[model samples]
Every structure is written in C-alpha cells, then in structure tokens.
Target: MATEQPRSSGSNTQRPLTSALAQHTQKKQWKDLSTPEKVVTATKTTTNYAVIATGAVLVAAIGYAIVSELFGSNSDTRIFGDALEKVRNNDQLQEIIGTPMMGHGEASSSKRRRNRRIHSQVVLDAEGKEHLLMRFYVEGPDNEGIAHLEMVKDQRNKWEYKYLFVDIPGGVRRAQRIFVEYNKDAGLPAIDDK
Candidate 1:
C-alpha cells in the first residue's frame, strides 16, 4: 500500500487510558502505604464504641438508683406500723371512735348504721419506715363517711396520720370528716384548722 491509512477519528486515544491506569496504581500504593495509618483508624472506631457503651451503662445505673430510692420499702413500713399501733392504743381514739368529726351527727350515725363494721389496719411504707399502709371496710352516707387512719411517728415522737378512705359511692366528704376526727382523737394538731 502506497499511502498510510488515515488514523480513525472515533478512537479512544492512549493518553486517557494511561492517565486512568496511573490513578489506579497510585490508589493501590496509598493502600499499601503504612500499618500505622490502619491502626489509627481502628483505634478511633474502637474508642467511639467504648464511649457510647459507657454512657449507656451510666444512664441505666442512675435510673435504677432513682426508682429504688423512691419506691423501695427498705425499712419505712415497720416504722409506720409501729407508729400506727401507738396511735391506735392512744386514749383519744377510744373516746372519738364512734363520733363524727364533721357534718350532722344524725347523718354520720346513719352511715355508721349502714356500715356496721368499719375497720382499719396499717402496713409499712415503701421505704420500710412505719408510715405505709392499706385500708378497707369503712362506713358512710352521701355526706358523712368513715375512713381508716395510719399513723407514723417522727424523731420528736409526734404522730402523723395518713388517711385512707374506704370506697363509698358518694361519700368522699364524709370520709374526710372521719380522717379529721381520727387526727383530733389521736391528739395530733390539725394543720388545716391552723
């Protein structure tokens, strides 16, 4: 052939391919560069994981401590029970056991009639102190009701009455009366009257 064939205009020239190959080779060299670099990367990842785990553990421990302190009976129940027993044995309770602290005497008397067996008892408070309790079986009418009281003693030997009203369909006010009477009878100062 006399004249050389004209170079194809649509061909991908060698220059672009060579440059791409050089870039890939450089990247490979970067990967093989150093062990220390890899160790630093791994250390960063591990440290982040450790920090997150520690934070989670601390949060859990704090939550548990709060719940236990607030709700745990530890020893308050026994103290509350002892204080209530003391109140029960007091002379004033005997005198006011059948009397109404508020409202008409006739209505209170009627309610007592309907609920012949008004009873109460004390359990320990959640903290294991003597101020916690459960109450059941009260007497009352629409406006005059009876409640059981649980008492606790402070360091000064003063009694604190915790009031629990028996389930009466429409006698909450009456239940309050009963609570007040219990306190008055127990010889504890009435905070409300003050």
Candidate 2:
C-alpha cells in the first residue's frame, strides 16, 4: 500500500486573498504592539472623538438659533404677537371689526392664515433710536382692516409704542382709520393736524 499524505496543512499551497483597503489584521496585546501601530490607534480614537464633538456643537448652534428666532424679545414673531394682543383687546377695534377679531399677514385666498408671514422691518433712526415697523391684517365677522404699527426702543431697551392704527377701506362708504396708540410729536403729524 502507498503511504497517505495529510491534506490539512495547506497554508503554503493556498494563500489568503486580500485587497489594499481590506487587508486582514490580527489583534494584539498592547505590550506586543509596535510604536507606529500604537500611534495610529491613538490618532484614530482622537479623530472619532473630534468628529462626535463637532457634530454636537453644530446641532446645539442650530437649536439656539431656532429658539431665538421664534421666542426672543426682539424677534419679529414676538413683536407680532404683542401687537395682535393689543388689537384683540381694544374695545374700539372690536366695535369696528365686530367681535372675535382675527389677525394675520397679507390677505390670502386660502383659509389657513396661521402660516402667513407678518410683514415687518427694523431700522435705526438719526437720533440713534431703534424703530420697528410692521403691517398686518385684521378680520372679524363684520369687516376687515389693515393694521400699521411703529415702536421705538427706550433707554432701558424696552419697546415703546410710537403709533398703532388700523385702516378700513369701504366699498359704499368712505375709508376710516382707528388709532390704538399714536405719538404725534414723533415725526408724524397728529390726526387733527391740517
């Protein structure tokens, strides 16, 4: 009988296949690692931590910007809210526009008024005062009108009303204006002035 040869020892005959990017690496104890390998491992760990930290900071910045835009004291949305509150609570406005008044941006055909953008602007005057100007629409069961408002910041950085009024245009009758707050000496003539 011929002598049988073992087939299990095939490392020399069959070489393990690998690609440049996916070469197999064996795990080694820290003490067994070379100086270059240890440095590469540390660098990779630092890079991963750096990427995570950068992502966290970016997310936090975006969150802060959104919050400030919607809820900050000087934000347009906040000013719109304050003006709408004054309009809704005014007894004269309720009498003119009828009860259950609603405020919105420019007139639109769509019934969804919540998404409308309130038209507003902020400027610095020659007197070194900040001015906020805004215009919006108000509607009620009986009528509709356009509201204009101007506010100036006081020495304490608080908003003080310069003028707030509504104009109602009529079809069969003449137009009308209802003043909620007006400061005649602040560059604009009084209503009764010629």
Candidate 1 regions with alpha-carbon error over 4 angstroms: 1-33, 75-194
Q: Candidate 2, which ten residues in sequence have the lowest lDDT sum?
A: 185-194
Residue-wise C-alpha lDDT for candidate 2, range 64-85, written one tens digit per residue: 9999999999888898888888
Task: Estimate, for each residue in 106-182, the C-alpha lDDT of model 1 and write its tens digit.
Answer: 23345446423223344555655555343333222222233344566444445455453322234323322323324
> After superposing candidate 2, which stretches have Cα over 4 Å from the reference?
1-31, 184-194
Give candidate 1's whole-model lDDT.
0.45
RMSD of each: 16.7, 8.2
Best by lDDT: 2
